[model samples]
Target: MPSSSTQRNPWRYLRDADVLHAAVVTLLAVVLSAGIVWLGYVVHVWRIARRAPTTLRGRWVVLVFGRQLVADAPGADYRGRLARALALLREKTAGRVLLLGGRSGGARSEAEAGHAWLQGQGLPADAHVELEQESVDSLENLRHARGLLQGGDRAEVLPPVALLTSRYHLARCLLLARRLGFDGHAVAAEEGLPRTPRYLALLLMEATYLMWIDLGMRWARLIGHRRMAARIS
Candidate 1:
């Protein structure tokens, strides 16, 4: 009954409302799924941080993750991680310590700075320490470390390994180490993990990174990207 002059073309609209609604729903579903997965990672990190680190019996290697330097000196986080390593070494828990990190816009590489700090703190006369000063990131740090450990044998066949890093960093470190087949335990730099604001902020950032790596690796494996999968290996 509509008059010809009153007729309208549906195509006149720039977009269909139904299509927009479906797009929004799809986007929401993806976001919700991602958040759920990310939350799982957060919970995983929290569990590790709150638990007591496994005590190595003897002759274990403590992989001390490198932190950023503050004004050419070890920052608080850096010192905290190093201090934990020092304590472990003094207790004879770990026979060797491997400091990992490269030059990150500083006068010296993180490992080198850590080595110097260890010296200033007076390392054990018989202590055997190695510095991995070429890895600019955590993945590279762990990869290079595995190579150093491997030599000719695989990393999993080596002695027990402990990943020592900041409380906020333990989760990522452990994840990477395990992915790299290190079978490593986590040692938190700061004693008694508390749910502080700053710590939670750090966790959020770490969670994002954790999720990024997890999803990336998953997608890579899903797509049969052997080289990418092998890199995560």
Candidate 2:
């Protein structure tokens, strides 16, 4: 009589080397596909920055923030590009700029830097360049800037505003702008530095911060909505 002890277990066979190799390959494929999709989305956002609207009407304000101007300085190529873009905007909008941001180093605030840049370009003192000197990040920049604008009589009477930031940042910035009750368009400054290790590091940091800023914006909107509803009721 033949013993049945030699019968192979089906479960054990499934865990063999070839089967394991197949499973690993399948997982790698899925991961690679997901990476591709994410990259495509990033590219699309870049395009949005490059092609934002350039016009503002009688009732809207043109807001420009991020990276202060310095056309010639150390590790300041992005600031230079943004400055040039803002200069062009000033020409187009005829001095309707609402600059945001504060100092990066402990020396100055983002709003102060922005003010200095526009003033250097000969923007009048009354040219509508609002500042949020206390804001250290994008979320604070936008939130605080919006509050400053809304607190003014002109903002109450004018139409919604248009926000401008670097092109790659347009996606998240636009999201925050809208969430904060800005019923206006967002323009990408479309500025960049040469793709180098340092530049890439800056880009990565900016992207990571965008995610955190979005979280802050979510909470801001939730609270804003509740307050509005409470007032109505």
Task: Report, for every candidate in turn, its global Cα lDDT versus the true structure.
Answer: 0.76, 0.52
Q: Name the lDDT of candidate 2.
A: 0.52
RMSD of 1: 15.0
lDDT: worst 10-residue window of model 2: 1-10
Per-residue accuracy of model 1 over 108-178 as CA lDDT, tens digit each: 77888898998899888878899988776788888889888888667347656889988888888887888
Name the runs in model 2 displaced over 4 angstroms.
1-33, 53-59, 68-95, 152-158, 191-233
For candidate 2, lDDT tens digit of each residue in 53-114? Answer: 54444444666665543432212433543464455555556345566655554355545565
lDDT at 211 for candidate 2? 37
List CA RMSD, all candidates. 15.0, 18.0
Worst 10 residues of 1 by lDDT: 1-10
Model 1 stretches with alpha carbons more than 4 Å out: 1-34, 152-156
